[model samples]
Structure formats: C-alpha cells, structure tokens
Target: MKKPSLTILGCHSSIPTDKFYPTAQILEMKGDSFLIDCGEGTQVQLRKAKIKFNKIAHIFISHLHGDHFFGLIGLLSTFHLLGREKSVNIYAPKGLKEIIDTHFKWSYTRLKYCIDHIELSSKKLEKIMENEKIEVYTIPLKHRIYTNGFLFKEKPSNRKLNMKEIKKIPDIKIVDYKNLKLGKDFMTKKGKIIPNYQLTFDPPKILSYAFCSDTSYHSPIIEHIKSVDLLYHESTFLKEEKNRAINTGHSTANEAACIAKKAKVKKLLLGHFSNRFPNIKAFEKEAKEIFFNVEASEPLKTYYLDY
Candidate 1:
C-alpha cells in the first residue's frame, strides 16, 4: 500500500517573495490528491514540485483570505484552458462560490468541466467528506474571518491473507479467501473451525493528518486532532511577538507547540511565517522548547506519514 504524504507547495504568510510563497499544500492519500489552501503562485509551485494538476480533484480552502486563496481563479482558468473534462470539487467557506462566479462572469470564461462548491459554515468539528479508503473532517478554527482546518484520516483496511498459513491447511481454498480477509473464521468440510487470526494478518495501521490554518491559539482543536500522525499548524511569529500574533489572529511558535503537546500528535510542522523572521529556524527552536517532535515547514518539501 502507498503511504500517505504531504507536500508543502507554499509556506509563507501574507505575501509571496523570491524564497517563500503563501499557504498551500498537497496531501496525497488513498491514491487521491487534496489541495489545501491555494495561495498566490500555488500553480507555479505545484509545477515546480512536479505535481500533476489533473490529480488534484478536491480542494480544501481554509478561508477567504487573499493569501490563502488568491490563486484559485487562475488555477480554475488553467483547468479550462487545458481542456480538462473531469469535475473538480472545492470545499471552502460560503463566499468562495460567488467570488469564482463573479470572476468568470466578468472574464467571459466558461469551464468545460463541472466545479462543485461544497460550502462550509459549521462552527464545530464535523465530517465533510468521505470515500471508501479515507474520511475528512472539519476542525473549526478562529481567524480574522471564518476559517476551518481539515483532518484527513485513512479508513481501517481489510485484513491481509496469511498465504503461508493458508497453504498449510488443505481446507482453506480460494473461495474462502474473502471471508478470511473479512476477519471470519474458516469452516472445514468436517465442521472444524479455524480462527480468523490464524488465517489472516491484522490490517495495517490507520494514518491521519491535520492541517491547522491561520488561527490564533485555540485549544479546542486539540480534541479534533488528538494523536494524529502529522499536524501542520500555522506559526506566524515567535513568542516574543505574542501580542502581535494575537492582534493579527495568528499563533506563535510556542503556542503551536503547546497545542501539539496537548494533542499528543506524533509530529508537528510549523509554517505561515511572518516576513520579519529571516531565519526560519527560530520557529523550530521555540517550538522544540515545548514539543520535541516539531519542525519548521519547508516549501516544496514532502513529509510522509508512515509507521
């Protein structure tokens, strides 16, 4: 099975510079790509990261902030120009659909494919999307505007067939493989029963990731993201600028670390840095003071969620 991974396409705050772009990332899980926050220059970064545009069928926008979703119109136009036939699903705050419709209406541009807007308005944690292999939930966040973080969780997998054990038993045939994989005991012709544990191996561990976008120090999110394999939280400032962070509706590195520690997440990634900090390593340093398994998010870097 392919392991889940996240690629940071852009990790800056507010503006795009030569070295950094605004918030954007691609979470590749269960053979599907989920685009999180399409900041300015997101398509360019996606190309630089060698990610295919067509693979991104679902997009999760954290908010209506320009820095978080400015590039969305351009990407949609590009999809039309590229003659894409597959539909795209966008999960975002309520006003996004109107914005896109206005842009297209004024530009006299129409898309060949369908664009389904899944507007979000819940102020509490809720399940937003799901498929056979994975489930997605919303983590209500506090920002200048209405915003939401996303939780991606892989569903429990079916038990694997213990081929070696099966071969040793003549009663176990190909017809019984399905039941064995479903954690069902095998029945022999003589009415002897073989336990499922002896016939199959346990399913692989489920992996989960949470994306905490531009939000202040909010502890209520801890329950929604508890024990996640990976967490990407926005840390726009250091502890020295705690006042500034609060004023701007952003979290400091220290605050981000505190949330990670409380949630007991396996790993914490800090991003959405203010331009004032030239050396991003300071964010990592401050976060490490509280949470050991923390790192500064690097643009274009891929972080894997695996055992």
Candidate 2:
C-alpha cells in the first residue's frame, strides 16, 4: 500500500514573495489528490511540483482570505483551457461560489468541466466527505472570519491473507479468500470451522492528518485533532510577535506547539509563516520547545505519513 503524503505548494502568510508563496498544499492518499487552499501562484507551484491537474478532484478551502484562495479562479479557468472533463468538488465557506461565478460571468468564459461548491457553516465538527478509503471532516476554527480546518482519516483496511497458513488448508479455495479477508471464519465442507486469525493477518495501521489553517490559540480544536498521525497547523508569528498574532487572529509558533502538545499528535508541521521572519527555522525551534515532534513546513517539500 502507498503511504499518505503531503506536498506543501506554498506556505507564506499574506503576500507572495519571490522566494515564498501563499498557503497551498496537496494531500495524496489512496491514489487521490486533495488540494488544500489555492493561494496566489498555486497553479505555478503545482506545475513546478509536476502534479497532473486532473488528479486533483477535491479542493478544501479554509476561508475566504485572499492569501488562502486568491488563485482559485485562475486555477478553474486553467482547467477549462486544458479541456478537463472530470468534475471538481470544492468544500469551502459561503460566498466562494458567488466569487467564482461572478468572475466567470464577467469574463464570458464557461468551464468545460463541472464544479460543485459545497458551502460550510457548522460551528462544530462535521463530516463533509467520505469514501471507502478515507473520511473528511471539518474542524471549526477561530479565525478573523468564519473559517474551518480539515481532518482526513484513512478508514480501517481489510485483513491481509496469510498465504502460508492458508496453503496448509486443503479445503480453502480461491472463493473463500474474500471471506477470510473480511475477517470471516472459514467453514469446510466436512463442517470443520477454522478461526479467522489463523488464516489472515491484521490490516495496516490507519493514518490520519489534520490541516489547521489560520486561527488563534483555540483549545477547542484539541479534541477534534487529538492523536492524529500528522498535523499541519498555522504558525504565522514568533513569540516576539504574540501581540500581533492575537490582534490579527493568527497563531504564534509557541501557541501552535501548545495545541499540538495538547492534542498529542505524532508530528506537527508548522506553516503560514509571516513575511517578517527571514529565517523560518526559528519557528521550528520555538515550537520544538513545547512539542518535541515539530517541523517547519517548506514550500514544495513532501512529508510522508508512514510508520
């Protein structure tokens, strides 16, 4: 099985600089790619990352902040120009559909592919999307506007066949392999029963990831993100700028680390850095003081969630 991975397309806070872009990421799991945020220069970053456009069928927008979703219209337009036939699903806060519709209406351009906009407004945790392989939920966040983070969790996998043990049983047939994988006991034609444990091994460990976008030091999120395998939390400021962080409805590195520690996540990836900091390493250093397993997010860097 392929391990889940996250590719940071951009991690800068508000503006796009020559070296740093805004917030955008791609979470690839189970052969599906989910786009998280569409900040300015997202399309360019995607191209640089060599990710095929068609692979991204779902987009999760945290909020309506310009730095978080300014490039959405351009990306949709590009999909039209590329003649993409696959439908795209966008989960975002209200008003995003209106924004995209207005842009298309004025430009007199219609997309060749379908775009489904699912607006979110719940203040509590809610399941927004689910499939056989994964389940997606919203993490209500405390930001300047109505914003939400996202949680992606891999579902429990089917049991693996123990070929060596199964080969020992003469009565086992190819048709019985499906039942064994589903944790069902095998029954021989002679009425002898075989335990499931003897024929199969436990499934792979389930993995989960949480994306906490721009938000303040909100403890309520701890329960929603507890024990996740990987967490991408926004750390837009350093300790020195704690006052600025609170005023702007953003989090400092220390605050982000506190949440990670409280949630007891396996790893914490910090991003949404402010442009005032020249060296992003300081964010990681500060966060490590509170949470040992912490790293600063880098643009185009891919972090794999594997044990």
Candidate 3:
C-alpha cells in the first residue's frame, strides 16, 4: 500500500505567528493530494515546504473562519498569475461560493483555471467524493458555524492471487485467475469447483485518515471516524483552560484524547493550538495521560499513516 501522509503547513488557532500559522494541511494519498483549510500564508508555507502548488487539485475547508480560509483568494490569485489551467475542486460550506465570488468581483480578478465549489451542509454525515482510489466523507462538527471535518478512506484493492495454488490447477486459465482475484469461485475445465478462498489471499487492510478541526468536544463524531488509522483533532487549549475551550467551541488536549480513545483510532494528531501557549509539551502530556498514541503537530512536518 502507498502510505498516506499528512504535511502540516499551519496549525495555530485564530492568527498566524512568526512560527505557527493557522489551520492548513496537505494530505497525500494514492498519488492524489488534498489541501485541508487554507489559512493565511499557506502558499508561503507550501513553497517553504517545497511542495508543488499545482499537485493539490482538491481543497476542503472546515468553516468560514478567517484562519481557516483567508488565504484562499491569495492562492487562487497566484494560480491565475501562474497561468494554471487545471480545474480546482473546493469543498466548503454554503456561503463560500458567494464569498469567493465577491472577492473576485471586488478585486477584478479572473482565475485562469476553473474553480468548482462543492458546498457542504452540517446537517448529517455524507459521502462527498468516491473514486477507485479513495473515498471522502463529511463529519458534522459542533462549532460556532456550519463546520465539517473530513474522513479520507482508501478503497480496498483486489485480493492477491495465490500463484502456487493456481499452478496446481492446470485448467485454471487467465480468465479464471481474474475471477479468483475478484473473490469469485472458479470452475476448472475438468468441471471441478475451486473456492475463491483457496485461490486468493485477502487484500491489504484499507487505511483511513480523519481530519477534525475547530470542533468542540462532540461525541457524535466518534462514530463517523471510528477505527481510523490516523485522526487529526484540534486541541486548542490545555486542561486548565477547559472553560475557555468550551466557550470558544474548541477542545482541550484531554478532550481531544478522549475522542481518540473512544473512536479507537490508531494514532491521534493534535493541532489548532492556541497562541497563548508557547510550549506544546503540556498539550502532549495532557493527551498522553488519556491516550498514549497522541502526538502534537508541528508546521511543515510530514506524518505517515502506517497501518
């Protein structure tokens, strides 16, 4: 399996600091890349990280918060300046289309490429995109506005054919091999039935990654993102700021850990840190106390999801 990797461009909350920007990340899986949230200076971070700007064809925005989508116009303008022709698909909430349209109208900017805006609703869980390579779903989150987290799941590949076992059956033709690999029973020329289980081995386990940003401690999300290989949850506050976290519709490190533990995720990536905290060690320590597999996200760091 080609491992899915996450590269964090920005993970801070509200605004961009000298060190940390807001919530932007690139998830590369099966040779396709997705940009999750385009905060201010995301293009700069992407350039600094040495990632190609055109490689990311899809962008998923969690909410309309400035920290989450302020850089979108700049990125689009840059794409226009670079003379890009490929269409970019943007999956965001309902008002984003109008926002982008207004920005372009006011700035008299015409994009060189097509921008396909797919609006998301926070009412329920829905499958946003599915192809042979990957599947993406929306996870409704509790926030100040209509927000959604995304779940990226890899599609299961065909079962591997057992060559030695197939060789034993001389009547097994190329067509029969295809059937066997598809988990179908094969019939030999001698009229003998070969079970699919005997002709093929199970395929590699499907991998999944969930991105939860700017959400409060909401229990319903646990079900949607259950058993994901890697989970990125916002941990905007420490335990001491629990009240602040609640008031701001954000999660504490401990709360993020609790969600990861309940969802049975293999690993938890904590991000969207508040600027008030200089040291992220406290966040890691607090989450590790509840869930040992938790790690804090660092800007420009790539984390591979190994199942």
The 0-to-1 C-alpha lDDT of every candidate, in the order given, reads 0.95, 0.95, 0.92
Worst 10 residues of 1 by lDDT: 171-180
Q: Which candidate is the best by TM-score?
A: 1
On residues 107-151, what C-alpha lDDT tens digit does candidate 3 reach at each position? 888788899999997579999988889999999999898899999
Backbone atom clashes (below 3 Å) for every candidate: 0, 0, 0
Looking at model 3, report the run of 10 residues with the lowest lDDT sum.
Answer: 172-181
Candidate 2 segments whose C-alpha is farther than 4 A from its true place: none
TM-score of each: 0.99, 0.98, 0.96
Q: Per-residue error at 183 for model 3, in Å?
A: 0.6
Model 2 per-residue lDDT tens digits across residues 198-284: 999999888999999899999999999999999999999999999999999999999999999999999999999999997999999
Q: Model 1: per-residue lDDT, tens digit, 76-182?
A: 99999999999999999999999999999999988999999999999999899999999999999989999999999999989999898999899877888988888
What ranking emerges by lDDT with the best candidate at the front?
2, 1, 3
